[model samples]
Target chain A: MITKLAYKNILGNGWRSLINIFILSLVLTGMIWMQGLYDGWSRIARRQMQEWEFAGGHYAHQDYDKYDSFSLDKSFAAVPPKLQDLIDTGDAVPILYSAGIIYPHGRLTPVVIKGIPAEQNILRIPTTHLRIQDPDTQILPVLIGRQMAKSINVVKGDILTMRWKEVNGAYNAYDIQIVQIMDTPVPSTDMGQIWIDYDKLNEVKALKNSCSVIVLKNQAASTYVGSPWNFVSIDQSMKGVDAMIQTKRVGGYVFFVLLLFLAMIAVFDAQMLAVFKRRKEIGTLIALGMTKRQIIGLFTMEGTMYMLLGSVLTATLGLPLFFYFGFQGFPIPQQMSDFNIAGASEPIRCYYSPIMILSTFMIVMAVTVFASWLPSSKIARMKATYALLGKV
Target chain B: MRKLLILTLLISVSVGMVFAITAEDILMNIDKNMTAKTTWSSSRMIISTRRATRTLSSVNYSKGNDISYSEYTAPAKEKGTKMLKMKDNLWLYDPSTDRVIQISGNMLKQSVMGSDLSYEDFMDDLELLESYTAILDNDITYDNRKCYKLILTAKTSGLSYFKRILYVDKERMIPLYQELYAKSGIKLKTMKLSDVRKVGNRWYPMHIVFKDELKAGSGTTIINDDIEFNISIPDYYFSKAILKK
Candidate 1:
């Protein structure tokens, strides 16, 4: 009977009811949109990290330390026979790295030389550029990232002199031709990096059958335990990305609360007006036979119905916007390419899950009902005789 | 017969005493021929890399072993570049930037003018015998000249090269070849001197080659075109004001 009365009053209010529903719907839509974008951003970053930087995971030499560059000189050893078989079968790729100095246009710049197989599909680096069939000239083909090329002021076809220490600590230098400038989202791979063929780099460094790290296609296929090598897991390697996403999600919650506050304020104001301006209606209900508790219950139910309708309204408007953006992702700004943000080099697409949508709807509805119940509870303390005279 | 045997033993003892030479004496002799109170020199430095070879001409003024100033005079791009070395410190003046940059810490390890020589190589001020203990290895012929091979081991842990093998010319007391070794026993660099000439009473090597074994290519060759020893150089020449001029 209270529900019937509440339904009649909402329909009778018309425009006033629509305004409350509209505010709730707007807040719900904004929350959903922001959540979807953040989810999409993190998803892409993880995907790119897995595809380009860490393929499944890696096994590195026991002595290899990335932070200490001096270790690069002594951090390599011959690949074990078991891992060698995986590399031979195309399930893994061996990377050899060392510190080097390059002279481009008579300026000396320090760089790290990474050697990988031209035929391996383990990492997303463009290794085909390192494959050159020039038998007459002894020029080695090398690939540098776009940032490195820009900083060094070199272009494709430019020949630069590269000097590095051999395994025996002897220094050697040779001319290298820039075959390609690679574009990668990961700055660690591109900045101050030079990629060459695995065999050619080994020959240049005078290190035969040696590799610094072995990247595997399947991280769990083989156990490299008990060996003098470290097995890095994908989760451990991509921990930075995970931490960044979690921090961003925390910031997103602040916005969610602000939107919820705005919507709650509108519902609270409407309920307060119902208690004051509809005192005559409240008095007549009490005089006729309705209890004060029943009247309060009706008002709270009315506020909750606004959220229910708002959710429906949001679905009608927001679904189309989500679908359109999901199909054609928002283009990432050009300036973002220089940012070290992992996986942010690509455009962002909105990701919507049923659980995310339903939870947002439920939280908003509960807050709206509480905002309505607060002012409606004041009616229970008013004198019925004074309310009947519309003086309360 | 007993008197004749005594006379033979005395003659053999006198001959052995005359041939005895200590490692310290050889090192002191080489140092005496190499060091001077003050010197004024004009030379050309040729640095060869895998890409190309570049030549730089400069004039240098030095007082003792601690203070020296060098100004580049050739190569249109590097013209007006000056380097001043006071003891262990090195400062470079660039005409393009109009700035003076101090080469210190890791910057000392970088190549100078894309050459195999580093800034640390230029500011080497340690006296040889003070930091190293020497031993004579053997007498050998190098570059068609009879020489004494002297092995020098660093007395302290702080020297750049832990050990050095030097071949010194017997007559001139000048080093003909030097092999520098790292603490790990790795041969790091080699220096060879040729084209000896008599300047006043002292013999000097006009052509010198410094090869860094850790780098590829032919290394750097410094040819001394004009060398004047024991010259009075003005104190203002080594000052910072002379760099811009």
Candidate 2:
């Protein structure tokens, strides 16, 4: 009986009830869309980082600190025998890095020279471009990222002079040719970086079989340890991005809560108005032998029914919008390509997991019901005689 | 017999005059007039930027071309700063942090104390005669003094400047002007020395100006206020421990 009356009353009010339901539906859709986009962005970013830069993780010399360019001189050692076996089996790729200065068009800019195997398939870097076996040309072949090339003002087939300190503390300089300009998402591996063949760099430095860090294919397959070399796990390597996502997630929650609060206010206001304006109807129902507690229960059910209808409205309207967006991913801005933010340069495809959708639905519904009940509970405090006379 | 002997003597004298001044002879004379076995000097470096000018005073000690140390004595903020250069290594001591950091790699290319000179320039200990092959180009008048224009080319691949043009005073064997060039023949920097004085048997320039062509504004001027050559500077002065004092 209460359900029939609540349904009739909601339909009877028409536009007022529609407004409440519409606001609630809009809030639900916005929350779902925001969460899906955030998830998509973070997923792409983590994948790019793993594929292009970290590569499961790394085993680095103890003094090999990426932040300290000064440490690059002392951060190299001969590849350990255990790690060497992994390299031979194609499970690892050794990388040697040193600080260098390059003069492109006679302008001096600092660079980090990274040497990796030209034939290795360990990392996603396009190292095959460095495999030009030219015996007659003294120009060393090098690969640079697009951003680095733009900043240094050099393109493929351009020859520039590069200067660096050898392992013996002697300086060496020579001309290098830009063979490729890579397009990669990770800026740490791209900006201010130069890629060369590992063997050639070793020959130039006169330090055979030495590397700054060794990248592994599988993080969990080895437990290698030594005095000067230590392993960094994948989670440890990506901790910064994880923390950044966590902070953004907290901000998303605050925004969702604010949206929920606005929708709840509309429901609460409608319930308060119903109790005030429908006193004569309440008196008539009581006069017709309905108990006062039953009258309160009816009013409460009326208020809760708005949320039930709002949820149905949200599903009918939001699912189609979500599907449309899911098919056509959001376009990333062109300027975002210059940012150091990983994966932001790529289009974000919305990811709507069942768990994320279900939880969001439950949380919004609970808030809506609670918002209805708070105002309807006032019926219990009012005197029945005063309520019947519509005197509050 | 007297006529034949005189004719042979004249021929020998003419030949000796023709082969007298080689590139090595001029370079050795310039090196002798430029450096001492050990020296102590009080100097001031004045750097001028577009915004303002800063003057720094220091007491410098050096042995040959390799080991040198300098402690900033003025401009209160830089008073306790010290630098020690031994061979290819350079260490800077900052009193505020009480930390000694070795300047290496790319850091060597940065300017020293916002001056036109880089730490690499400060740590460069290569003697011109040992690192380059000099050729006598011509004689030119520079700064109202007759100068021998000599061109020096790097003997190896990795020297900072691949070629340099130097003008040495004909009488004093002191360099009056120099132009440094990169491997691509780009003019990188230029130095002009003046205020020549006779100290002992050698003539030295008391004032020098170094200009970095890559930058704007006026160049850096280094004035040797008081200098004592071939003095007894103890070996401990060049040690890293002296930086703390």
List of chain B TM-scores, one per candidate: 0.94, 0.93
The runs of at least 3 residues in candidate 1 whose Cα sits more than 4 Å from the true structure, single-residue gaps closed, are: A12-16, A62-74, A132-137, A389-392, B1-245
The positional error of residue A233 in candidate 2, measured at the CA in angstroms, is: 2.9
Q: Write the per-residue lDDT of candidate 1 for residues A152-185, one digit (tens) a residue.
A: 8999999977776667544556678999988887
Candidate DockQ values, in order, are 0.06, 0.20
Give residue B54's error in model 2 in angstroms. Answer: 10
Q: What's each prediction's TM-score?
A: 0.65, 0.77
The C-alpha stretches of model 2 lying farther than 4 A from their native spots are A248-254, A279-305, B1-106, B113-116, B125-196, B206-245
Lowest summed lDDT across 10 adjacent residues in model 2 chain B is found at B180-189
| Residue A266 error, candidate 1, Å | 2.1
